[model samples]
Target: MPNKLEQLKKMTVVVADTGDIEAIKKYQPQDCTTNPSLILKAAGLPGYQNLLGEAKGWIKSGESADDVIDKLTVSIGTELTKIVPGYVSTEVDARLSFDKDAALARARHLIKLYEANGVGRERILIKLASTWEGIQAAEELKKDDIRSNMTLIFGLEQAIACAQAGAYLISPFVGRITDWYKKSTGTKDYPVDEDPGIQSVREIYRHFKAHGYETIIMGASFRSAAQVEALAGCDRLTVSPQLLGELEADEGNLKRQLTPTMGSDKEDKVSEAEYRWSLAEDAMAGEKLNEGIRSFHQDTQKLKDLLTGDQAQEKRAVAQTGA
Candidate 1:
């Protein structure tokens, strides 16, 4: 019998949710994804020292720390493109989540940087938070053939809005949703089939397939291998290295849990007003979305600080040598 990871690949596209090149080589997932947090973690890895040095070199060339961060992001993404056969998701600045124009401009710049590095736009998915402004930015980018992966999705309304905006892909956070529910209900464990996270993805999957929306649904932010196993037949799943290793070791019989089903209701395009109202009503969605953005933004700032510290050290070394 094949391992659970191999079995999962038969029904869904497995995506590595880390920035570790060594892990990507070992698992050989179909795609790879990175956000500010993942990139920050990857920056400290021994293998990425050259990329970090190059980014610092950009600072010596008069690029600001922010610009160097962007360059480093694309540099890391360029390396991932060589390993993954499918798309690599590079995120926009999380602080720009609510600013449509700035987010759009940043996404375009990231794509341009990737192209400059010889990785075409086709191999990249510009990741954005699932804010209203972010959705609008994605809508306009799609007009120019730039695909986007809408991340931090917590509610079905967000998924519907992204689908209506013609987003190339949407990543519904499974573990985060479960985390919210578990805290609220004071429950420690949930049966695999009854897991709130798994149920959330199943709802989104059914809605998309039933309504004939072309946008792909990719489940992200898993907590356990059981959560991953529950959504085995999803369109795609972006999993962390720890969970991937667990799945690789388990030789359990994985069954197809989610499949397309026809629905009697007609599809409705979500308006901005409706989208905002839906999120406002759903406390979990609103809070989680805000929290996710803040967390990513914090990591972005931390990355900048790490680079700035390096820059300062280099300057002191030069001054001491001259003296």
Candidate 2:
């Protein structure tokens, strides 16, 4: 019997959800994703120092810290494209999540940077938060032939909006949903079948498949191997390095938990008003979306600080040497 990871790949695309190049090479996922948090973690690794230095060099060329960060992001993304045969999701600034024009501009810049680095827009998925503004930006981006991966999705409303907007992919965070439910209900254990996060993705999957939406559903942010196993037949699952190792070691029979189903329940497209109202009603989704944005923004700031500090040290060294 093949290990669980191998078996899962037969039915679903396994995406390495990290910035660790070494881990991506080991698991060999079909695609890979990295957010600000993952990229920050990768920035600290010794192997990525050259990438950091190159980004800092941009700062010396009079680019703002934000532009330098974008360059660093695409620099890492460019390397990943060499390894993965499929798309690499590079996120726009999280702070621009609510600004449609800014998000669109930044996404365009990122794509241009990738193209300059020899990776075309076809190989990249501009990751945007699943806010109303972000969805609007994605809608426009699609017309220009740029694919988008809608991140921070927590409800059916967000999923439906992304599908309606023609997003290329949607990442429904599984572990974070489970985390919210556990905290709210004060329950430590949720059976695999009854896990809130798993159930949420299953619901979104069934809806999309039944409605024949072209937007792909990729389950992400897994907390355990069991969560990964439960959603075995999803369109894709972006997993962390630790859980990937767990799945690679376990030679278990992975069953197909999700499959396509066509239904007669056609629904109207979700308008912006309806989308916002529905999201507001879902307390868990609303809270988690806000938390996810704040967390990503904080990590992005941390990355800027790291780059600025390095630049300051270099300046001091130059002055001391009288060069």
Candidate 3:
């Protein structure tokens, strides 16, 4: 019998969800996804110095902060694209979530940056937070030939909206949902199969398959090995390095639970309004989605600060050179 990882791989695409280039090179995931938080973490790491230095050098060239940041993001994305045979996800500014027009504009810019850097649009999925406004933006972007990844999706309403918007993909945040339940219950003891996050993704998988929605669902933000294991049959799962290592090292049995045929067989009838109301009732999901966007927006600001600081220093250096 093959190993559990092998069995899981047979069922779904395993993606490395990190900005850590070393981890991506080690795991050799089929694809990778990075957000502002992950990219900020990577920027602070000693190992990623070269990537940051490259970005700073561009800043010294009188490029605007936004241009420099996009270059930095695309540099990381291009590196990941080269390593992974599949597409890489690069996010748009989270601060632009409520602005449909701005979100689409930013997305097109990101895709253009990627293409200019030698990465085709086909290999890049612009990640946007799945707010109502964000979904609206995606709907228009799809018409313009720009594919998207709707992130921070917790409740089924977000999923259904993404499907209706004709998004290319949606990343349901499994671990964050699990975190909410664990904190609310004040207990760490949770069953893998019965986990709320796991169940959420399962319902979504079934719904999408049953409705014949072409939008792909990828489980994101896993907290543990069990969470990843429980979601074996998902279309894709973006995992952290620590969790991926745990899965790769474990000798225990792993089961593949989700499948397209199984999903097609498991159907549920829930209207969009009902789904939205139910999602609104879930206080945790509502709060978390907002918090996630705020966090990303904060990071984007921090990145902007870094680029601005670099530019100021470069200007001082140029003055000294002329003086």
Candidate 4:
């Protein structure tokens, strides 16, 4: 019998949710996604030392710190593309999450960098936070043929907004939602049927399918293979190598739980005010969404520290150049 992983591949597109190129090669996922957290983790490994050295070399030249970081992002993404056979989602700076114009400008800039590296927009997904502004930015980028993956999404509001704005894809985080519920309810376990994370993705998947939206539903941030199995028929699932391995090792039956037929229940489109109010009312989504943003923001700053080391030395060098 084929492993559950193989069964899953028959139902949905499996994506590697990490920055580690070796992991992508090992799993051979159709696509891969990365964030500041994953990139920072990858930068620390000996395998990525050369990449870090390359990024640091930009500093000795005339590149500004932000430019160097952007270059490094493209460099890393370029390497990932060599491994993964499909799209690679590289994020804009999380700090620009709430600024529509800034997010749009940076996303366009990221696409240009990818194109300059000989990877066309077809293979690149410019990831933005799923704030209202981020969704708006995605709407504009769509007009230019640059696709987007809205990340850090937590509620129906965020999901609806992304779909309404014509985002290319939206990553509705699953593990983080389950984690929030477990902590809030003081429960250590949930049947896959009752898991909040799984249910959240299922609801979003149902809604999107019901409405015939073009935006793809990619369930992300899984804590277990069970959650992955639960959303077996989602458009795509970006999972860590750890869970991918677990699925590979288990030759268990995996059923398709979110097919188009299951999503046939219809509803009206939500207004902007109602969207915000619905999201605010969902306490779990609100807390986790905020936490995800802060966490990503912190990881991005850490990546900045990694890319441009020795802040005092940098300051001294800048003062000495005095040009």
Candidate 5:
């Protein structure tokens, strides 16, 4: 009999969702993903200092900060692409989510930047937040032959919209939703499979698969080994290093529960009107979606500050020398 790992290997693609090069190289995930948060974490790590230094050199060359940000982001993405045999998802700035035209423009620019660095569009997935506007931007980019990963997804409405908009993939955040439930309930104990967050992704996965929607569902932001184990047969699950290590270490029973061929029967599907009403009722999703974008936008501003601060420091040093 094949081990549990073997069954999992056959069922779904495993992806490492971190910016840690060492973790990625150690596990050998089929694909990798990085967001501003992960990149910021990586930038602060000693092991990844060389990467930041390289970006700094580019900055010193008088490259515009925006160009440097693109170069730095693509550099990390290129490394991940080389390590993983499949695509690496790199995100556009969240600040652009509401501006469809600017978002589309930025997506094209990022693709061209990747191409210039010898990374083809086929090996890259441009990640966009799953806002209606973001979906519209992705639709336009898809027409231009650029693929996208719709991320920060929380609701079925967002999932359906992404599929209808022709997204190549959707990253539903499983762990964050679980965190929300835990905080609200003030409980530490919950069955892994029955977790609200895990269930959310499973529902999205089943909906996409059963409806013959071509958009691939990738469960992201897992918090525990149980969350990863529960979604064993998902199309793909972008797991963090801590959870991945736990899965690799445990020799316990791991079952394949979320198979496409054997789905749990769901209630009547949401009508368009129901979905809109549900969105209005679910205050958490509405608040979180906006909060997530605001948080990402803030991180982007921090990154810009880092780049601009370095330049200003250098200018001051030169002025002092001349004086």
Candidate 6:
């Protein structure tokens, strides 16, 4: 029998959730998505050093520091595009999550960098947080035909906002939600169907089909193969390299748990007031969304700092002086 991973590809689009080139080559996912954390991880790896050096060298050029950061991000995504046939997701700085204008400007600049390097706008998906402001920014960008991936989503409210904004895709993280529930309930184990993250994505998926929303639901941030297995029929699922490896090795009968036909299938129409209050009421989603933004922002600043002011020379001088 073929691997379950092969079977999964038949039901949904599989996206690689890491920036590791070797792993991406091994699994060969249709799309690749990276955040500041993953980019920082890659910056420390051996083969990625040249790219880091290149980014460093571009510092203090005619462009502003922010523009240089945007180019580095596009450069990575452009490299990813060479390997994957589908669009690569390049994230706007997480610090701009709640800033609509800043997010739009940064997203537009990232697309331009890709275009200048011969990759068209269609080959890229600008990733933004699923904040009300971010969703609004995505709505405006869509008018210019710049598709976006609204990520860091946790609740139905964020999902609805993204769909209403016409986001190209929204990744509701199943594993992170499961983590939140585990910590809150103090339970370490959950049945595949009962996993909060999986259930959340399943609910979102069913809601999308029932309501005829075109925004794609790509379940992401899975902790185990079971969560991924439980969301087999989602529009897409971005898997970590580790989970992808497990799925590639496991050959059991992987049954589809989610379909458009399942769930209450309610088309929920939410007002801005309702969206904000509902998100605030949901403890798990509220905390996680804020945490995700902070984590990403912290890593983004780290990446920016990596390129500032003669990194190598300063380090070498420090080494020579033994200070």
Clash pairs detected, candidate 1: none
Candidate 3 vs candidate 4, TM-score winner: 4
Regions more than 4 Å wrong, model 3: 60-62, 263-279, 308-323
Error of 5 at 65 (Å): 2.9
The CA lDDT of each predicted structure is 0.90, 0.90, 0.83, 0.84, 0.79, 0.85
List, in order, the clash count of every candidate structure.
0, 0, 0, 0, 0, 0
Q: Please give the lDDT score at residue 182 for candidate 4.
A: 91
**Residue-by-residue lDDT tens digits, candidate 2, 63-107:** 999989999999999999999999999999999999999999999
How many backbone clashes can be found in candidate 5?
Answer: 0
TM-score, per-candidate, Cα-based: 0.94, 0.94, 0.88, 0.93, 0.87, 0.93
- Compose the digit string of candidate 5's lDDT tens values, residues 1-323: 54444456678898888878899888788999988777766666677668778777777788877778777888888777878899899899888888888888888888988898899999999999887779888888888889999998887778887888889999988877877778888979678867888888888877777777889999998777777778888999898888777777666666787877544454435445655566578765666677788877766555655656566754443333211
lDDT tens digits, residues 130-182, model 1?
A: 99999999999999899999999998889999999999999999999999999
Query: Over the stretch 196-243, how does candidate 4's per-residue lDDT look in tens digits?
Result: 988888888878877888899999989888889999989999999899
Comparing candidate 2 with candidate 3, which one achieves the higher lDDT?
2
> Which RMSD does model 5 reach against the true structure?
5.7
lDDT of 3 by residue, 215-263 (tens): 9999998878888998888999998889888877776777778877754
Q: So what's the TM-score on candidate 1?
A: 0.94
Instruction: Write candidate 6's Cα lDDT for 128-220 as tens digits.
Output: 988888999999999999999999889888898889879999999888899999999999899988888887887788778878889999999
Off by over 4 Å in 5: 1-7, 60-62, 262-278, 309-323
Better of 2 and 3 by TM-score: 2
